[model samples]
Target: MSPKSLCFTVLVAVFSVLASRVVINPTPQVLKYVVDFGLTISSSPSIVAMFIPFDFDDLRRHHKNPDKGKPVSVCEDFPPNFPPPETNTTLTLCVDRNGCCNFTTVQAAVDAVPNLSIKRTVIWINSGIYYEKVIVPKTKPNITFQGQGYTSTAIAWNDTALSANGTFFSGSVQVFSTNFIAKNISFMNVAPIPHPGDVGAQAVAIRIAGDQAAFWGCGFFGAQDTLHDDRGRHYFKDCYIQGSIDFIFGNGKSLYEGCQLLSMANPVAPGSKSINGAVTAHGRASADENSGFAFVNCSVGGTGRIWLGRAWRPFSRVVFALTSMTDIIAPEGWNDFNDPTRDQSIFYGEYNCTGAGANMSGRAAYVQRLNDTQASVFLNTSYIDGDQWLLSYDT
Candidate 1:
């Protein structure tokens, strides 16, 4: 055979072997690169090949996105350089006759907090009646407003629904856009009333609109509309909430653990009118399926006669689990909100509830006694299963 023909034969043989093999290489950056070929010998020999290149930068960007999976950790610790915890030292914020804290008001201290501080910052409020409306915005979390005492460190305001040109649903201490911790503080509404029939006159002592807000060992005092536990998920432990009419009414999902529900008598009553509006008008519309008002190991006591609860609107859902009720509770346990048709849509239940008021013999047939498994859902703060956001609370 000629030398050129021999070279051609050798090249064909080498190509035939290469077609059946695959090659993989790893770059110094730990990316995998692969090359593969498949051979067909029909007519003249032909080969099909493919190449795959891994891009580390594209993968890194995807992992860093918050909506995607958890962010990649560049450092050993997940969150590098997290802020240190705040010291428990007390910072006295005195609101004097001119409403200033060391020449600055209480609002000034709240606004000055560094964002996302892990430390527990306590605002030690001195003994004086503060008249300004206070708001704890969401930017400043883990803040504790500690009062000298419930009475001594009182925050008093007279912003009624009528005077403020708002509804009882509007809060006096409007806790919006903030996760707050309040303890040993008294939130009072000093609103005067002319008559009991004045339906529009409403005063909210503390309206909590922030999610995950907590109140510990605090007293909320007002006559008509008080302690408006408004929208969002909130926890109130070891607190006293007092009001006369449908006071504790709101759309928020709340867990009142070991709290006191007090009822102030209609100031105009001359010992003649025996019946007062319901103590709790849960007002949780059905549109809010996960929204509810839960009372766990709470006590319901009042000066005048009051029903344990009433459906403030159609399709309200409320549950009182393991709560102690005083004789002030009406025999019926729940009111119809003056609409008999609401009986079909209202969801009012009691689970392991004890006391003279829990007697179901006289309770409306619509009122149910939830089974153990059913009541467990309401006991915990899992508005949605597996989320466990409520567990983040300092119960």
Candidate 2:
């Protein structure tokens, strides 16, 4: 069968079975330095037929009720247990660059929140470009960043890793507090994208190390290391994240629902067919760490051919379920970060993803052919344990 035939069609139901066991690709070659402008694929002699898994009953039930106490809306949510008796439990601080609001910058509003307060402090940012780096310290939890709109309200900076002394400090906005939320905001790193061999080219748009954080209708713009989802259980709904190499990296156990992953890397240079860049470089360093990335009902589209994900560290785990991928995905599907040894340890899988690039014929050997029992683990809010804290979500 052709590589296209091996892929799941857009109409294919995940609950159905993939009945055939066949080696669709005769040869699999890693395309890095080779000129591959045409994105030509050569088949290889590999034994492959994989299982497609899905909990049909559970999926239907979950969709019937997506809001499970997770803070699903930006304008309609308050911290849990903020009884109506205490009017001070909910606070709204306005930030306007024009000085019409309570604060002139995003940071000032964040500073106004009392440290370690149980109340939810909402910082409403007016529509404008706020050129500054803002950090919500770990001490200040339960804060919400509410903006007029993602495109109209932006917090931007132009600090490269070299300029910031390291990638850890280069984010336009860094949040270290728990239960943080962002709505209709854009966090941007405006530094010029760097080419290969360029020193410290990484520019981070946002870094979220806080647990139980949620982002709704947010946009993250940058080149490399765009989202430092460094370590946490985070939810990103209807968000747009654009970047180049290792853009969406970090060890966060995140669920990217209905988000768009855009690539900005110049994959082909001139006549060179060489492909560069990857959508995600999940940095799960150990098997014991309950950290992984799950993209559900997301779309991957943009310039340049890149891997859906690459193993940035040993035991890196990432899965894309029911996502629509374009031809931008490289044939190899994934990379072991150029280290063959790491391949055995990484957990990479795709469950019922559809697109021209969704064919598994030329995927890496380590790609998991998940069964329903296995796929269920990463296909829904349960992957991030949203039942515990999140009040609700869209299916």
Tens-digit per-residue lDDT, 1-395, candidate 2: 44333222211221132112222231111100111112122552221111112123322333344557443332222234322232467777788654554788899889888999988887878665676789999999988898766645778776789989999899989999999999988887766566655789788999999999999988888878899999999999888788778889999999999888887677565444466778999999988999999999998877787898888899999999898988878877998888999978999988998998888888889898677788889888888999997745321
The window of 10 residues in a row where model 2 has the poorest summed lDDT is 27-36
Candidate 1, 104-199: lDDT as tens digits? 345766776667665556565654445567777777775677664453355656566766888644455777654577876778665553135675
After superposing candidate 1, which stretches have Cα over 4 Å from the reference?
Answer: 1-104, 114-121, 138-142, 168-170, 193-195, 266-274, 380-395
Q: Candidate 2 has what TM-score? A: 0.77
Instruction: Give the best candidate by lDDT.
Output: 2
Candidate 2 wrongly placed segments (more than 4 Å): 1-86, 267-273, 393-395
Query: Against the true structure, candidate 1 has what lDDT?
Result: 0.63
Candidate 2, residue 132: how far the Cα is off, in Å: 0.5
